[model samples]
Target chain A: MTPQAQRDILKKHGLKVTAQRLAILDYLITHETHPTAEMIHQDLPMISLATIYNTLERLVAAEIIIVIDSLSDGKRHFDYYGQPHYHIVNTQTNAIIDAENFDVAPLLAAARQASGLNITGFHIEVYGVNPEDAR
Target chain B: MTPQAQRDILKKHGLKVTAQRLAILDYLITHETHPTAEMIHQDLPMISLATIYNTLERLVAAEIIIVIDSLSDGKRHFDYYGQPHYHIVNTQTNAIIDAENFDVAPLLAAARQASGLNITGFHIEVYGVNPEDAR
Candidate 1:
């Protein structure tokens, strides 16, 4: 996404556009590798780790991004919430592959019926290993 | 479970049957709340936070327990891996309700086909709010 587009998103979410926020949003938009805060900092060394964390927190609160902490590595991975989708996590490498094929609407409905609660959101992560790596 | 029974399970899992380990396991088995380390520490005041964390980590590594980080609260909750089941998270209260009625085998299979990876395990969390609380 262009820097202007990033700024627009930040503004749309009522977040003030800053260089740090734009850099992080741009990185997440450009990279699909669901990265941790530290990973994002490594790529954008100009931004301090604390700044990256604060900016990410704001974006997440504004619903501009989502956090995934279900991976085996026990690290929080952030993904741009452009659309709703599930994730496929590699158990060994901690790599995240977005899997939008599987629809979770049916399962969400089932959970609501079973629990009798007003459903809000859902998180589904399928853990797997590459066949080549397993071999 | 009785103390001896907990000890037996620990031994079976090749873990040493220490008092701290048994206490944590017993607490989890008795309480289905899926508590964080701090919550567990609150219940078992004698056990230090460090020991609770260490024991929980060891039990999770041994497959005797599982760590859930998918809740909106962003705290790691521990559950006994006695059987495979999903969780219903109360977004407002952070309470975890076990929902065993939903079968995820079909979903996992679909993810395997879509990603072409050797599926290992899966984590599913349905977020919701209790109707009474919602009202």
Candidate 2:
């Protein structure tokens, strides 16, 4: 989103649209892969770690973004899919693939009906060797 | 699970299922709240951290368990919701509530149809203050 758009979102959430917030959001949008707060800090040498922490919390509360736990490195890696989609993680390479196209709706619907259970949502992290590594 | 059951599961996955694994799984099942590795380690003073790490990976690969990222304290928390269910997290107290009954299927299905998007799965973490804390 443009600076103005981000600012509007911040204002809606009662958070100030600071330089740090803009940079972080901009970087996130540019980098399709979801990054942890630490990774975000790695890119911004000037931003304090505390600021990154605050920004993440604020963004999550605003419901402007969604954070998914990444099993990439067994660390607290997050993803910014911005929309609902399945994900693929190369456990060895720590690379992420936005699997927005893979269909899992049928699977979930079947499970829900079979168990007579109501599923709120599903979190799927597919960790496997890379396509090349498998060969 | 019993020690033998754990051992069988581990052996199937080429793991040892040692005393530490048994204790950790036992503690996990006994305590319904999805906990982080740190919380599991807190109860098992005799087990090494490496053991906990190894156990989690092995169990996940064996398809005997599942791990969801807990956003309770913005840490790499793991939830052992062996089966699929929605999760509710009280951010302030770090208490987890198993909200398997909340229905999100209709919402997800509608989302899938709205944009011709195939919804893979969803991770819903309801992070809020506890009842007492809110009061």
Candidate 3:
């Protein structure tokens, strides 16, 4: 998305539009790779780690982004919540790849029946190793 | 499971069988609520929080229990890994319910094809609200 679009999203979410927030949001939108605050800081060296963390917290609170802790690595990974999709985490490389082929409606239905809860949504993390890494 | 069984399992995992470890493992086996260290300490008040944390870390390291961080509560919940199953996290109550009806083999296959990863296992957390809480 364009910088203006990112700024508008921030404004819509009642977050103050700032250069740092715009950069972070733009980066997540452009790069589907789930990144931790430290990784984001490494890429956007101009932004302080504290600022990146603060911005990420605000974005998460606004529901414009989501925090994923399902990885083997203990760090919190951030993903843009613009679209609905599942994640495939590489256990060997600790990479988060987006997988959108399978439908989760049936699984959600089963969960609703099994748990007797009004299912809202779901998060599925498939753990595996790359073919070459498996050997 | 009996205390002896728990002890044997711990020994099989190369973990020293201790009274505290036995108690914690038995508690987890009896209660599938996916409790955090604080919750475990609340029930096993005789055990120090530090000890509970230490034992939990050891159990997790031994692969006797799995840690779940998918809940909205932001607490790492522990579950005995006696059997493979999925989790249904009640977003409102933050309760982790075991869901076993749905088979995830197809989903894993799709993820493997989609991401080109040699599929090993998967973790699914279906978020929802309880029936009464939903109304």
Candidate 4:
């Protein structure tokens, strides 16, 4: 997110734009792949895990991003992508790959008719071996 | 899965249907809601967590069920339902609830057109506080 847009969103979510929060958001936006909180803390060495956790929680509350809750490596992983997307999980290694394009129409239709829910939105995780690695 | 069906799926997955495996499958079928390996161990009493884990791994490989990987309480939680469905998460308490029905046609269409790819299926998890609990 741009500096101004990030600030605007933080304000909208009633969150104070702290350096830590901005940094976390910045990491989320610019980071190429999905990462866990521990990974985030590791990347921003100066930041404490607690701060990352707090910032992520605040971000979720503000609806600025979504927490994947994917424990890729026996640890909880978070993906802060503002847009909706699905993840392909490497169960063997617990690696997370961001999926850019996959149409979920047939599956969604089948699920909706079966469930009868007020599904506001959905977070998806597909646990599987990487196609190439499997080969 | 019954003894016969269980044997069939195991054979299909090229797995050996051990007694432990049968027990785990029985546990999943008769159990209500979704239970992880730890929870399954706790419920079965005599079974070890390791056994549960192995059984779950085998079942997933057999394509009999999907691994949820929902760490509702910072611990990996598994949903054994063979059917495709969405989950309602209580972010506050990290509770998992099964949502019976919701349509994803519009959203799927949007995602499909935006990212062109063959979507075999999708799994959804809505990370939010329960509406009733929120009130």
Candidate 5:
């Protein structure tokens, strides 16, 4: 997106636009693969790791990005868009692929009734070894 | 269960039964809520934190206990049983409640076809504020 558009997104999320935030946001938007904080840090060596981590926290708080926790390992992946989706994680390679959107309303409703809890959001990660890797 | 039963579980998983492992397993079996390594350490003051961590690692490798990653924070909670079920996390209180079992076969199939990935296992965690706590 344009610089002005990036600023508008930051403002919309009630976040102060900064060069560091813009860089991080731009990186996330451009990268198709779900990347961890470390992966992002590697590509942008100029930005300090602390700043990357801090920026991610603010972005998540603003609901600008979502955290995808890998089940294989405890590492987290960040997504720029807020659209609802599940994940397909490669168990051996630790590759994270977005699974198609599956309606979870029925599951959520059943959980609400059974647990008597107000459901807000859900995370689903499917783990598998890639077929090529298996072969 | 019984002392012999516990030992059998360890042997079946190719884990040599040890006092520390037994203590950890016993605690997990008795406790209903998912407990983290640190939480387990707090309960078993006699055991060193490192030993607890090591034992948890071994247990996980043995497929003895499953790790439940909390979305509110990144902390992992441990459960002894491996039964297929989902978790309902109380966002406000950080309480982890087991959601009633919902069949996810269709969802898994769709994900496999779309991603061309051989799916082995999956984790689903629903986040929400408890109605009772909200009141």
Candidate 6:
């Protein structure tokens, strides 16, 4: 999103418009891969680790981004776009890719039917060796 | 499983049978909920926190248990059976229950077809409020 749009988003969420916040969201907007705070800090050297985490927490609270904790690694990953989606991880490399437009309705139904539990959100992740690594 | 069966399974995994290990596995076998190392540690006070973590790692390495990294909370959860199953978390209570016999073959096939990535394994979790709490 444009700087203006990001600023508007912050305002809409009752957040302060700051350069640090803008930079963090902008990085996520440009990078397709879901990233951790360390990755964001690495990408933007000007941003400190503390700032990165604080901004991420604010964005997540505002529902602008979502935290993904399902990867093989124990680290927390952030998704800039909070829309519903799934992810697949490259086990060896720990690389993550978004699985867009994947449907989980059938799987959710199956679980609800089998367990007799009131199903809610589904967090799905697939792990495998990236084809690029095999080359 | 019976005591003999447990012992045989441990032997098959090349793990020596110990009272602490047996106690840990026994707790998991009886408790359907996916538990954290801290939970196990709390239940088995005789086992040190370090020992609990070590045993969990050993069992996970042996493929006897699987680590779940997806829940809202950051702590690591373990599934003892290591079978193909899903989990649902109670958002309010932070309670986790297994979604047994819930197949993910369809979801897996869909992800593979969409992403064109060689998917190895799928982790699925649902979050909702347990109805029992409403009572």
The TM-scores, one per candidate, come to 0.87, 0.64, 0.85, 0.73, 0.88, 0.82
List model 6 lDDT by residue over A1-135, tens digit each. 578997898899999999999999888877877889999999899889999999999998777887788565677888876567877777677777776666677777776666566765667787666556663
Q: Write one digit per residue (lDDT tens) for candidate 6, span B1-135.
A: 798877777789999999988888888777876789999988889899998998888887777887877555778888876467777766677776776666677677777776666777767777665556652
Candidate 3 has what TM-score? Answer: 0.85
**Weakest lDDT window of 10 consecutive positions for candidate 5 chain B:** B126-135
Q: By the lDDT metric, which is better: model 5 or model 6?
A: 5
Error of 4 at A61 (Å): 2.9
**Could you tell me the lDDT of residue B82 within candidate 1?**
84
**Model 4 ranges with Cα > 4 A deviation:** A70-72, A88-118, A125-135, B84-121, B126-135
How displaced is residue A69 in candidate 6, in Å?
2.6
Tell me the deviation in Å of residue B71 in model 1. Answer: 4.2
C-alpha-based local distance difference test score of model 1: 0.86
lDDT measured at residue A15 in model 2 versus the true structure, 0 to 100:
85
List where candidate 6 sits over 4 angstroms from the true fold.
A70-73, A110-120, A130-135, B114-118, B130-135
Q: Candidate 2 — which residues are off by over 4 angstroms?
A: A78-86, A99-135, B1-3, B41-54, B61-63, B74-135
Cα distance off (Å), candidate 1, residue B134? 7.9
On a 0 to 100 scale, what is the lDDT of residue A35 in model 1?
93
Q: lDDT of each model, Cα atoms only? A: 0.86, 0.62, 0.86, 0.66, 0.82, 0.78
Which clashing pairs does model 2 show? A122-B122
Residue B40 in candidate 6, Cα distance off native in Å: 1.4
The per-model DockQ list reads 0.79, 0.14, 0.83, 0.27, 0.72, 0.58
- Across A69-128, the per-residue lDDT of candidate 2 in tens digits comes to 655465555555457665555556666666554465655554454443443444544444
Residue by residue across A16-64, what tens digits does model 4's lDDT show?
8888888888888888566778889888989888888888877765656
Question: Model 5 RMSD to the real structure?
Answer: 2.6
CAPRI quality level assigned to candidate 4 from its DockQ score: acceptable
State the fnat of candidate 3 relative to the true structure. 0.98
- Winning candidate number (lDDT): 3
Off by over 4 Å in 3: A11-16, A45-51, A131-135, B45-51, B130-135
Scored against the true structure, residue A25 in model 5 reaches a CA lDDT of 93
